[model samples]
Target chain A: DAGITQSPRHKVTETGTPVTLRCHQTENHRYMYWYRQDPGHGLRLIHYSYGVKDTDKGEVSDGYSVSRSKTEDFLLTLESATSSQTSVYFCATYRDPANTGELFFGEGSRLTVL
Target chain B: GESVGLHLPTLSVQEGDNSIINCAYSNSASDYFIWYKQESGKGPQFIIDIRSNMDKRQGQRVTVLLNKTVKHLSLQIAATQPGDSAVYFCAEIPSSGNTGKLIFGQGTTLQVKP
Candidate 1:
């Protein structure tokens, strides 16, 4: 297993509240990714970071923002939580930049918006 | 838009039988593919991966086959066991101009019945 860990394994928040999930990696991987998994939708990329300060939006980046201040920490923030945002979020890391290697994923964070 | 998809949403096989899961990707430029397994309440785990240059790769009790012409990928599990029951997903990385991002397909639930 990779040295990836996600904080707040389970969270329940009310609508309009701000929620932030943290992903920490000890492997010093170069690329880190945030994804959400829902029934019937598989896993959808939310955001990803290539370096300490480099980040990019994914296919489903709306309502979600990410920041990578250091090489080991990547944060995902939902400015305003919504019911539709309730899903299991996963953080993954890859050592290669060409995306040819296997991605190691953390356990997951289950967030519920009431 | 290019996407990856599975042929079936669910598959059931008796224990000790071989199991096969299929995936179809729309992007012809995709050269790297991976298969992941996710148990209940857990994040996806890397199972096997194959590069476009190869037609097949084998691991312990697992085989990954790639067909570049049809953009098809398959995973074969030998002697399926109860532990093999999980949701399987196929992910791909485009060959050209890829920024180390992975696109996932809808998952296939595998049930190994005893």
Candidate 2:
């Protein structure tokens, strides 16, 4: 868990609704990432932030947008939720600079769009 | 589209026996690989990681092996216990523009029979 917390652990909303998931970390990490998990797809990177206000898109970033106004918090927002966007979202922070892939993930937020 | 995949969707093993989970990646350029364990109602946790420079890496009771020529990776757990029962995923950091964007395999569910 590494002091990482995600708000709205579970949410059920209708399609076309707006949904926002929040990830907060207690430590000052240089890297933070958002990933989504589906049935057939293990986990796909949605977005990531290297530094405060510096963010980049990932493998499945088409329907999502992210913001990192502060180093401890990264937010993912779906302007208009779709059924396809219903999945479990995870937020991770880098463990070591040398091994960038090593991450400490949060509990995850489950969103269901009907 | 180069993707990571698992040979078996599920693996059943007896307690105290060793278990091996295999993964394959279509992208040979991927250099960094990692394994994650996810239990029910929890986020994925980092297990181990290996760089392309080395073929094998070991942790407390887990080992990760990478075969670059065949674009394959495997995780071996010794003395499998009930706590070790979870879904394991293999992820790779593609040697591309953004290495932080890790691509994950579908995952293998390890069921330890008591």
Give the winner by TM-score. Answer: 1
Number of backbone-clashing residue pairs for each candidate, in the order shown: 0, 0
The reply for model 1, stretches above 4 Å from the true place, is: A97-99, B97-99
Considering every candidate listed, which one attains the maximal lDDT? Answer: 1
- Which portion of correct inter-chain contacts appears in model 2? 0.74
lDDT of 1 by residue, A37-98 (tens): 98888999999998999999999999999999999999999999999999999999988554
Q: Quote the positional error of residue A50 for candidate 1 in Å.
A: 0.2
- Cα shift from native, residue A4, model 1 (Å): 0.9
DockQ per candidate, 2 decimals: 0.70, 0.71
How much does each candidate deviate from the true structure in C-alpha RMSD? 1.3, 1.5
Query: Native-contact fraction for each model?
Result: 0.58, 0.74
lDDT of 2 by residue, A26-72 (tens): 87777899999999889989999989899999878998999999999
Q: Estimate each model's TM-score.
A: 0.96, 0.95
Clashing residue pairs in candidate 2 are none
